[model samples]
Target: MSTQHDAEIDALLGRYFDGLYHSDSSVLRTVFHTDLSYVNGTDGTYETMGLEDYMARIDARTPPASRNDPREEVVERIALKGDRIGIVEARMTMLGRNYQDLLTLINTDEGWRVLTKVFSFVERKD
Candidate 1:
């Protein structure tokens, strides 16, 4: 049986994926902490951004609603520390690339919120 913590984490991850696909900053906001940071590894370099900047980038883009893209997320691992922190590793396919992301989350009074995301993406050769 899944615990409340498990359910909460699941919901949080779901919202994250949905937010990315739909480009809905509001939905993303609910799951991300105010101090959010994302470190992205691409090509042979790394780029990082804060929550506001990332959300703004999303807001400026056209929503992917018309893309009908496949969102296949595989949760590779989940590690819970004490009761307040969790680290989740997941892989998904998007924009013709396969991405692996590590999300750090914190359990707050309101709920679990993602604090940081470190990810790497590689183009699908197939």
Candidate 2:
């Protein structure tokens, strides 16, 4: 892929972080596919989420940003596979917990959108 494509993916990731921090479903919808599958294993049991349900959960929450404790998310890696598929790993911290997310993205006609996510979290004792 060209540098331009890489830049676009980077920009999309930026929006992802923004959406996650603010829990803004609008911003999130821009980057997540309609058929998204989200998985969380923080509790030692897997919890799965679908796109619409996840959006609804976002809407019901009070954004951490509003509390001045917005989650901090960092993109650790982005690996593109050919022109259509990519993998992204990111870290986030909020409420004394650290989160690690591995996202699968596809470059669709609408642009690069996350198709699936697998995540885990650990609570900080200190």
Candidate 3:
């Protein structure tokens, strides 16, 4: 990838990570496609959900009170096959647990938007 492409991917990574940490749903919406879907691993089960359902689930699980001090870390790897498509793998640590998310993004009329996401939890040893 050229330096400019790398920079764009870096910016996208930063926005997505910052949004998750701050629980900024508006930012999340911008990164994710309207029809985005994913399977979230929780308690040894993979629960599939769409964008709206996922947002509601996030709202339900993350209490407004607890978000006063939300913590997050994201390590991402991006691969660009061409100018309009890329894959992003993000390993995230949030609320003392680790999760892995693989996302496919496409440059659309509105800019880069997430096409699909596959995610799973990673058991942390402490």
- Candidate 2 lDDT by residue in tens digits, 1-126: 365578889889899888877889999999899999999877876899899999999899878788888467788988888889989999988756788999999999999999998999898676
lDDT of 3 by residue, 1-126 (tens): 365567666777777777777666777788888888776756678678789987776555664325564355565677777778888887877765677889998888887888788887766675
- Residue-level lDDT of model 1, residues 22-91, one tens digit each, is 8999999998999998899776869999999999998997666658866678899989987899899999
How many clashes (backbone atoms < 3 Å, residues ≥3 apart in a chain or on different chains) does model 2 have? 0
Clashes of each: 0, 0, 0
Q: What is the C-alpha local distance difference test score of each model?
A: 0.88, 0.88, 0.74
**Shift in Å, residue 76, candidate 3:** 4.3
TM-score of each: 0.91, 0.91, 0.80
Name the candidate, 2 or 3, with the larger lDDT value. 2
Cα miss at 30, model 3 (Å)?
1.0
Residue 22 in model 1: shift from native, Å?
Answer: 0.6
Count residue pairs with overlapping backbones in model 3: 0
* lDDT winner, 1 or 3: 1
Q: lDDT score, residue 47, model 2?
A: 90
Residue 29, candidate 2: alpha-carbon lDDT: 98
